[model samples]
Target: MKGTQSLERALDILFALGDDGETQTIAEIAQRISIPESSVYRLIQTLERNGLVERKGQGQIGLGLRILELAKSLNSQFRNRLKSSAAPLMEQLSEETKETVVLFVRTGTNVICVKSVAGQHLVRFVVEDGKTFPIQNGASGKAILAFETSKIINQVIHTIETDLVDDFLEELQVIREKGFSETSSEVDPGIIGIAAPIFDQANHVIASVTVAGPGDRIKDEKLSAIVPHVIKTAKRISSSLSFSTTLS
Candidate 1:
């Protein structure tokens, strides 16, 4: 329809402006997109009215704060869903293991802790919520990196300013074979953590679940004991996200 075409053009114009990260005059946009200057002006005015775009100075235009507001609203909805589904599982895991349980997502080259539940034990290593960790240093980060595609893995590695690429790759291979990753005092001194990847419906590693505690308390025997439980909990969380596991 003519109306739909007009709306699409207007959206394209706004997207172009967003990509440039700078204000553009009507004549400049019209020249770039090969559209009439009059049409460009009309579209800009319409977008401005809806707070999607705003005039910066003179004839220049840029995105408005309304888009950020919309993004925050969407992020809040995601946070609510994560809490409802993952929080209970985190609590259950913490109770069962008597260690701190955390949920993290890989953002760029860092893994961010989004949710955490403290164990019943009085003494435990505490990781703050919203903490960002490097991909090569922690159990949770390694678990996520091991399951991610080779391209993504390499991209993350490229961001690291270290000569440990070969070492990291070897560790990742081991993690892939073992179906989980573990580290002792790698990220935090005197602490040990084990992590398993949480996958989505398409088998994409979207996040990881980890259990961390004092090194002495998380010895090899205890880690071996907790492996099955951690894997099961990770699978349960994945299932709640509509992900099917291949684990028998």
Candidate 2:
């Protein structure tokens, strides 16, 4: 292979290892990628030196912690950008409602919490960064799903239990009409979550911003008060992302 071909082959090997998420012997990688065993070994040695791969045992290797280090750095940079765009609005919402505020993005069948601002109360619901949960059962999930096309919803529905599909679609429509979602004691008992979908420059729902709090404090009156703020915050964040994308 030429130098560029060799580099491409090396990347193919890396991708193979990543997809399997298992330790592989030199012969195994060679067979998987149709590379010669000798070439695989040489490529692996170079990858290992750069800390992209690590030996697992005799004649076996797996991805290294260095990949995770790189992932953390990338996630950090992305989170900083999202936080910078949303923090001021989130802080204001938290202060006004005194409830936990969170930002979430879809990941396959789940939504990952990316940023959060804690409520100023002795008792409040707080979601940690990187927390992931099913995209079928909560306000954030519904808000994100509501904006998706029916085709996308059908794709997600295929992953869900056959029995719950109808109700899921029904709720998504309600959220779509209201332009937000609110639920009490759905994910966690005694907690109420309200969320609105955030769109990108193309008007695609890419994320959601939520306000959640103890149910006792978020009864009818309180819920009525916070709903508009949550919706507004989501809109502002979406506008910011759209504007930034336009500039870039």
Candidate 1, 1-248: lDDT as tens digits: 28998898887887788765788888988887778999988888888898988889998888888876886797677556655568888888888899999998877778989889987678897888899988878899999999988777888888766787788888999998988899988899999889999887787898889999998888978889988888888888888876322331
Instruction: State every prediction's TM-score relative to the real structure.
Output: 0.70, 0.69
Q: In candidate 2, what are the lDDT values of residues 210-238, reduced to their tens digit? A: 99999999989889999999999999998
Who wins the lDDT comparison?
2
Instruction: For model 1, state the Cα shift of residue 133 in Å.
Output: 1.9
Candidate 1: give the clashing pairs.
Answer: none
Q: Give stretches of model 1 more than 4 Å off.
A: 1-71, 243-248
* Candidate-wise lDDT, in order: 0.84, 0.89
TM-score of 2: 0.69
Which 10-residue window in model 1 sums to the lowest lDDT? 239-248
RMSD vs true structure, all candidates: 5.7, 5.9
